[model samples]
Structures are given as C-alpha cells and as structure tokens.
Target: MTVKMIAVDMDGTFLNSQQDYDREKFSQLYQVMKQQGVRFVIASGNQYYQLKSFFPEIEGELSFVAENGAYVVSEGEEIFTGEIDPEIIQEVLTILAKFKQGHTILCGKNSAYVNEDEPDSFIEHGQKYYHRLKKVPNLFDVKDDTLFKFALSFPVEQVPEVLVQLHEALGDKVIPVSSGHGDIDLIIPGIHKAHGLMKLQELWGIKNHEVAAFGDSGNDLEMLKHAGYSYVMSNGQPRVKVAAKEIILSNDENGVLLKIEELLGN
Candidate 1:
C-alpha cells in the first residue's frame, strides 16, 4: 500500500471511450500523490503529442514514455530516446505501400502523416487521440528527418496476418506490435512501454515493486507484466487478462483512478 510511483497507460487504461480526459477525481488523486512525494509517470505507446492530450493543464509535471517506450520526456526535457533506423522505417513504408493498399499512418515526433486513402473517421480519430497531427495527400513524398513508428489499420481479424507479413519482411530489426483493435505499431526493438517506465523509475529512484501499472491492449502486455503491481481492464484481451496480477473495472468505469485510490488509500 506504499507505492512511490504510479505508471499509467493512456488509451484504454486512463481515458474513456469518448476520449475525454476526466480531471476531477484524477486531479485530486494526483494532488495526494504529490503530497506523499510519489511520482506519476504516463507510460504509453503513443507519441509525445498524443500523450499530451491527457494532461493539458499540468503539462510540465507529467513525464511521458512515447512511441511505445522508445522515447521518454520528463519535465519538458528529453531524458531517453531511441529511434528506428531511418533506412528500416523507410523500407517498411515502401513494402507496406506496395503490399497493403490500406491507410498508412507515419508517426513522428509531434505530427503524424496519413495518405489520402483513409476515411474521414480515421482523421477525426487521429485528431482526437493526438493533440496535433496532419493528414496529407502523400506521406511517402514528405522528407522528414526521423520517424518513431509507422502503423496500418485493418480489420481485427486481419491484423495478425499483416503483422506476420511485416515481421517476415523486416525481421528482427524493427519491433512490430498491436495498438488495439485493428491496428499494429512497428517500432524499434527493445523500446516498449515497460522500458519507458523503467526509465522513469530510475529517474524517480523507485523500484519496480513500488509502482503500479495499468493497461488494456497488446502493446500494454510487456508493461503490465513488468510492474510490481499490474492490472488489466475487464474488457482487455484474454491474453492480457491472464498475464496481469489483477483485473479491474473497464475503462468506462474510471478503472485506473479507482485502482489508484485503492492502492494509495487516498
């Protein structure tokens, strides 16, 4: 019951289905943790901009593990970062461009680019998930300096096939994992949500057991398993539920905040 740091996931773990950030209870719990000197780290598979959507008011206080733990930003500073080899990212993009004609989302630092082959909802969802992003006519033609990750959206049943094809094509050089239903994220190997949380743990001088983590998707598996105290959403994948130390309420029930109060006894 004496946790020194709380590392939370973003999408399904913290936010509700409507994608609105619930502030009242969460803000109060955050104040309690602050008074106890326990740090809060937002460890997620999202980019920095996407993660920023959750804590717009207290931007400076939140630390983030972005792009599936390949990057970390603390107190508005870059504490840890690992980039996918530019050549590998470009190669994957080219191959996917040829093989799959579906929408391709190019994830970078602050913005993500998507080809014109997406539905209007895709853009709107991206806008909702990320604080800022751009949908362009052609993503491949854009000359960006670096890319953190790339993703493709297809039917849930087809995701495994797509991921297998991508993994076979790219091999071990790039890390390919799922974001949630119908989406797969290709990031650099060794960079995951758990890795990012460990970085924050080091920064805050806390041990793994002193932290409690929550998540609800495939990308969250590694992170959830690594936490001293871990939870999976009631609506989470079967595999994830099995791996977690405990199962909590669904996101709609404000499960993350409920667990926070339970663990810290606030």
Candidate 2:
C-alpha cells in the first residue's frame, strides 16, 4: 500500500518533556516525505496557537486537527470546525469546578485560564516552547468566543471517576480525550482524533489505505485503530500498542524518522 499522508501526535509521540526534538532527523525525513508527495497533517488536542508554535515555518504547508478534532485546517484554510456550545461549556465548567475544587484549566484560542496554579511539566514546557503564552488565575476572567479546550489534571487515580462524571454531565455535547498524563480533555461535539484525521484524508483526496499515523496515548487509539498503517511508540501506552498495526522505537530513538527512511527506500 502506498502511504500518501502521515498524521502524527505531538507531546509524547513527537516532543519529549524537555521540549527538544530530533530536528536534524525530522527535517531530513520531512524533506523526503515532501519529495514523495506525502502530505503531513498534525493531529493533536492542542489549540491552534500551541501547534503553530512548534513548526512556525510550515504554517503554509501543514494541516492540523486542533482542539481534538474540533477544528481542521488544510493549507492555511479551515475545512471544518466544531465548537462547543457556550452553554455547554459553562455547564461543564461548573461541574468540573465542583469536582476539581481548584485545579482546572480552561483554554481559549491563545491562552489558558486556571482555577489555581499547579506545578506540572506542561506549565514549564509552555514557558520554554511557546511565545506569548499567558496564564490566568481564574476562568471567571475569561471571555468566550474563542474557547477551544478545557484541560484538567488531578491526582492520577481520580481520572477514571472524573471522566465518568464529565461524560454524564456533558452527555453528547462534548467528548473527553486524554493526553496520556493525569489530564483529561474536553472538546466540542463529535470531534475526536479519528474524525479529524479522516476529514484530512478526504480533503486531500487520500484514501484510508494511503494514510499512516503515529501516536502514544489513549487519545490516539481511535485513529491508530483506523489508519492504514498505525504505529505506536515503544514508550506509548499499552492499549495504544494493542490498537496499532506496528510498533516502532520510542520517540527519543528517532523511530518515526527511521520508518520514513525505510518507506522512502522501498
């Protein structure tokens, strides 16, 4: 099967906690992929600003599945957008606040508002990698219209119950996805990784058998299961491995780059 498109996740699948990337290897593979007419779509739960921060130079070439499939962009143009209803967001926020007490993050297009600041690797990583990233102490101060994602982190074990509660509260209005941390993500209705990636395929006229994907979390499962040739990182979650068609080396091991090289050689 010929792979005409590749969709990859960011945090665990591409960037490590240190915010460092295998730039040289990735650049080389990107060049090869381009030469072969393969389109690269970045599929993640991150907001548009967050995704653009990583590869600012490719704003024109890259397509994105931002806010966990709530939005889709191809060639700097929007192909689809599924924003959560404002009322639903407010309701969900109230429910989350009740459970979280003081540890929730409400994200807009370009910023994140928090109930209380907590120490997390994501906070530090944002400081190091993002330009003009801001933090708000409360969601009450946040104005809507650009709201995209609501991410919250609590004690790891609390996640299962928290997710169930969110599903119960939001129902079909929003969907929950995980970033593979203790965090849970709330996105607009019908917006999942799989849906967004499939949209990308249709936009580019690429068939399911012509698509490949790489990811490392529970959030990545749907697409990993649906892609033509899905790959899970060696360090990825066990369930991700179960869903993937193949297993590659860890992100730190330049697994994606090596695989791309093999694909090009063949």
Candidate 3:
C-alpha cells in the first residue's frame, strides 16, 4: 500500500467495547507512522475534546476530524469548522421538544450542552463522550457557543423513523448519522467524516489514493467511498460492508493496528 495518511473511526471501528484501545501497541505504531511520514487522523462523530483526550501523549502528533466532520483540528491547530444556521438549530430544537423520549445534545465547540432537567443517567452517559459538559436550564435558552452538530440518544428502533422525519422536515438543512448504540447525530449537510479527510488531503497535498480509512457504521459510508483504500470492520453494518474495498478483523481484535503492521511490513 502506498498510503501517506491513515484515518480510523472511533466507536466500533477502532476502540473496543471497553471504549479504549491498546495504548502500548498503538504508541508503537504511532512511532512507525511518524517515522514514515504517515498522518494519523482520528475521525469520529464524537466530540473533539473527548477524541483528543484519549491520545493525550501523541495528540499533538495527530489530527482529529471530530463531530462527524463538522470540526477539524490538525497538529494541535484548529483547521476548519462547519456551523449550523441558528434558524435551523431553532427548528431542530422545536422538533426535539416534541420528542418525549431520548436526550438531545447541542454539540458546540466550547462544550456539549444538555438540559439540566435530564435524569442522572443521561448526565452520566453524556459525560462519557463529552469531557466539558454543561447543564443548562434548557437547551433552548442556551445560545452563547458556536455549535457544530446536534445529537440524540434514543431507542435504536426510533433512529430510522426519526431520521426520516428529520429529513422530511428539515430537508437538506441537516443530516442524521447513527454513531451506533442508539445514538444519532444531526450534522450540517455536505459535511461528514470524508469532508474532514479531504480537507487534510488538500492541506498536505495528498491524493485520495494516498489515504486509507477504516470504519464500521452507516456514518462511515462516505468516508469508505472517499478513500482509495477502505476497510470495513467484520462487524460493520451490512450496508457499509458493501462499499468497503476489504474487510478486517473486529475492533476487539485490534484490526486497525494489525492492518497497519501488514501495510508497513512490520
């Protein structure tokens, strides 16, 4: 493989069910990639802060395409950000207010905002993915921060229905992507994991063929098609698997790392 950049999705693609990866092995791989001038990009629907926090030691050496491509940070610098129109956000909030079930999150650059009226379970779950979380009286009353994506955690069955409703109501204003585990994110239209990768590709003058990507869900479809070389996790969504150039071991098997080793002849 003639790759200059490697991008990996977080949840089911790279991190095991324990919400973590093998640091020692990954650190070693990081060293080798750095030596070979391969840019390592962490692309996910997760918050930027949470994503970077996982790789504290090598964070400055890596790039993050977070919030499902609404935000991009490279080498410790903010490269780009996609913002949702305030009017559109208001429309979304109105729709969500009628949704009795699930928790709504206003993903912002400063922090992930939630309704303080939420139960303890919601707060705890929010904390897991958001490092800097704020509990406001109501998400509607908050408007100080620049927002990127809108997220909801509800029943898996509701995902498809809600997404269809959102599409019908909002049209191309916003898009929804599942982050697995009954979590869905509404991001700005035309922005996704692949958008972030393309930004990095342009900045580094690397072509699509020079980038290899790994992902495991519907949100990863665009990215899989964007990369010249793309791998879908063995446990990936059936739809996504159809688009990948190849299939790899599950996340628990350290497939990303193993694939890298094979590619680099380690």
If ranked by TM-score, best first, what sequence of candidates would result?
A: 3, 1, 2
TM-score of each: 0.92, 0.87, 0.97
Off by over 4 Å in 1: 117-119
| lDDT per residue (tens digit) for residues 1-266 in model 2 | 58898888887887766655777777778888898999888888777667877777777788988767777888888887775567767787777667743256666655656544655655664443234355667566567446767776666777777778778877877677667667678776656888998888777788887888899987888888778989999989887799998999888877777776776674
Stretches off by above 4 angstroms in model 2 are 115-141
Model 1's number of clashes is 0
* lDDT by residue (tens digit), candidate 3, 1-266: 68999999999989998999999998898889989998999999988889998998878878999999988999889989988888888888997777787789899998999999898898899888888889999887778888989888988888878777767876777888878888988889889999999999999999999899999998899999999989999988888899999999999999989998887678
Clashing residue pairs, backbone N/CA/C < 3 A, model 3: none
Q: lDDT (CA) for every model shown?
A: 0.79, 0.75, 0.89
Clash pairs detected, candidate 2: none
Q: Cα-based RMSD of the predictions, in order?
A: 1.9, 2.7, 1.1
Per-residue CA lDDT of candidate 1, range 87-186, in tens?
Answer: 7766777777766534567877757777666788877666655555677777766566456777667778888787788788878877778888687787
By summed lDDT, the worst window of 10 consecutive residues in model 3 runs over 162-171
TM-score of 3: 0.97
Q: What does candidate 2 score in Cα RMSD to the true structure? A: 2.7
